[model samples]
Target: MNRSENTATSAAPAKITDSGQFKRSLGTWSTLALGVGAMVGFGWVTLVGGWINDAGTLGAASAMLAGGVMMAVVAFVYSEMVAAMPKAGGEHNYILRAMGPRWSFIGSWGITGGYATVVAFEAVALPTALEYVIPLDHLHLWTVSDSDVFLSWALVGAVTAVIITIINIVGVKIAGSFQMFVVLFLFLIGFLQIFGSLNAGEVSMMEPLFSNGWAGFFTVLVVVPFMFVGFDVIPQTAEEVNLPPKKTGRIAFISVIIAAAWYIMIILTVSSALTPEQQANSSLPAADAMATLFSSEFFGNLMVAAGVAGIVTSWNSLQMGASRLMYSLAQGGMLPAWLGKLHPKFGTPVNALLVLGAVATIAPFFGHKALGWIVDAGSPMIVIAYFLVSISFVILRIREPKMNRPLRVGGRGNFGVIVGATAVAITAFLITLYVPGMPAGLSIEPWIIFGVWWLVGAVFFVGIPGGVKPGPNAEEELMEKVYARYPHRRP
Candidate 1:
């Protein structure tokens, strides 16, 4: 296979940043673990099952397949961008290079909100899941009553936030290793579920093809994007990868392939094991499906334990990745400078972690029902971000025709990858609006909160200094500053 000149050199030890705080310690498998850990939490357990129940097995599966395909196209485009720039800021860096500093700043605002919101969502999900396994009616800690479910959720979120912060501070090596373990266990549990259900053969996978029609199909389409969000996160770690662009792109492709197949198995297993009525009404569909297949008390409990563990692990990784991205953006002057400070000894952006924790901790009290709203608001934000990123890819290809692409998606002359990705972006945006106010039977007033948040983000992008449009002279000055700090990284 052909390789870029930097390919061989990339394997050499990565030079540490001047602050001596950031370094690239991740390998291919470690990168894959990061992607898996970010995407496979509560969504895999409750979200996917709930989705299947809403649209029926056929509609859910097809939408997931479609979403996965769309994400794959995006992965290809994103991989190409990261391979070229390999910066820690991920989408922020990509947008700046392709669109301009101003638009990139706008992109950073949305990306920051997405990461923070999702992390908070994950933190709250853990305690909510615990209510299923534990009977804590009268427990009290530090004069606080756990009786108020929201209080318990806040406490859990706080504790998990601390754990994630500590892990990130200790360094990427430790954090990445923990993520690897989480992914391994999650994969084992998922596979066990798929095989155990497949063995029963009590239900047919193809019994109903598309029972929900376009309405059902669109509902699933909107939710499936949440499940496949981790692939894009791979680019966020570009600067920390041993082979910045090439290795990052290759590992991302592997991650998408692995995650897609795993998610499909989950859909199939759940579909085969649950009846229509059981699926629709069941609170925890995957766990219920496993129980039906096994008819064993031990396995039933195992499903709950595995599901909770998955949520916790996913919560941890998402927070870590998101905070790091925010920290990177802040250092570039796209955000408040205070957000960029690293703990003197711990080597972490502890303040940023605290900020993210604050957002997530308070979110649950806003009402778990409101999470749907946050998600709805976040959905359009991501779609808009994706649209820009994809457009950036095509523009960059034209602007930098001589630029090296360590991994290109289509043939020499074919723009199918670009065209297809753009089409998916449009489709995803259209489908997303259908579930804007929440589907029937669900109250999603919290989306208003996100709507307000988006407006605030817009203001930040336009109001802050060096926040946007660094100007032509400023770009060169900024490059000289960045290079002076990291002399080892100069081309």
Candidate 2:
């Protein structure tokens, strides 16, 4: 196993100075909000009926429960690694430490691809949602995959993308504050839905608890990983947190539990509020459930407002995460160094944020169908990165037995290996779920998306100067050289 880049010191530890570094500002609670906000995206609002219909009520909840357990186990691996490292590039640093630059590129690329998908998905999701709220019947400029791209609808998402991009580039502190406020609103809306369900909705409406047995269960299981992807964003922004390193990691764990419970409760409440026939007939079950149970259009509108909040939370955090991961790759000489440049005053990754912004703004032009397929394609890549991080954790345990861990988990030797092996086993199984011909096999369109993305990633991998190597300071040494090029950079 390769030694970690963090394990380096010839003379009392190097100062590790750099012109572009993030300011530490986030506390544990704010950090938790960020993670929870990302995980609980627009899916619950729009897709709850689909999930329940596919797997039935109890089966869907069971699948989510299993998926949540898998994610929690993966979070344990992340908790240990983040406490020990607490660096900017979450999986990139860990994979580089255990594997090498080549594999690290693969893992980093995987997550970057995933984050980019969510960013783009939210761009179109915003517009599609507003169409529901306002009922846009304008003429579309064109059509793709049977989805229209009307000027008014596209403008909503594009405008949101630009606004979100600017908010991120201004600074992390402002962004973090906004996240906390919106997440609280999201919780309040959630409580409204649950209370309405309890007061007027019928529990007897939740029939056919198990549908098609295991086949139905795995269908919901396949999408659960993507739903839980936001928990790792906590580690991606590890450098900016004000809490102790171990606590930052623990916040990630807590966020996972909260998000998981949030989804299950959403499924249960939606089930109670709508019968199977009503769910099938309704377009947005959660929102309609709100209006139906309470007999007020205002309640449905509030649920739509919650959907907007989900969009903001997911978009804000993912744009931050994607930019930082790109910045990290650039910092390490794996990407163009210019993309790594940070604002001298704001301390945000301006160039990186712009790159994602441009992509997201243009994605609405492609219509919602294509972007939905892109998100599905990117989901597998994210799992690949998670699997690699799990591998890195086990390797680090064996290689750096004495490394300092502020919040160490598992036992020494065999016990630690058991924890890592369990994570690896679970992640690997999730990866297989994406393969073709399986019960949870993805469609051919997503496969084409996967090929195109990896091909682009390969191009950048070929441009790195020193290539892949095995050593303690391989990435550290390479990144310092990149930093050397812009010695006196200013805002």
lDDT values, one for every candidate: 0.65, 0.84
Scored against the true structure, residue 398 in model 2 reaches a CA lDDT of 83
Candidate 2 lDDT for residue 101: 81
Clash count, candidate 2: 0
When summed lDDT is taken over every stretch of 10 residues in candidate 1, the lowest stretch is: 9-18
Residue-level lDDT of model 2, residues 1-491, one tens digit each, is 22342444211111123445688888767798899999988888888898899889999999898889989999999988888778777888888868888888899999999999999999988877776679655776999999887888888889889988998888888889889889999999999888888899787888878788888898899887789988898888888888888798888888889999989988899899888888888778889889988998889988989999999999999889899898888777778768878788888889999999999889989998999899999899899999999999888788777766677777565777788899999999999988888766889998999999999998998865554454456565655554565454212
Tell me how many clashing residue pairs each candidate has. 0, 0
Instruction: Provide the lDDT at 426 for model 2.
Output: 93
Native-referenced Cα lDDT, model 2 = 0.84
- Writing each residue's lDDT as its tens digit, candidate 1 over 1-491 gives 12454343232212223334556677877788887777777767676666666566767777777777777777777777777667666777667756776677666666667676787777667777766677533333332222244455557665776677678777776778888887788777777897788788356653565666878877777665567666667777666666646778877766766777777777778888877667768777777778778887567667777777677666666677677677766665556656766666655666677787677666555445556556655655555666677777777566555455666656455583566357446645644454537442223444566678767767656643442333222334444454565564344
Please tell me which predicted candidate would have the highest lDDT against the true structure: 2
**Candidate 1 lDDT score at position 201:** 37
Question: lDDT of model 1 at residue 181?
Answer: 81
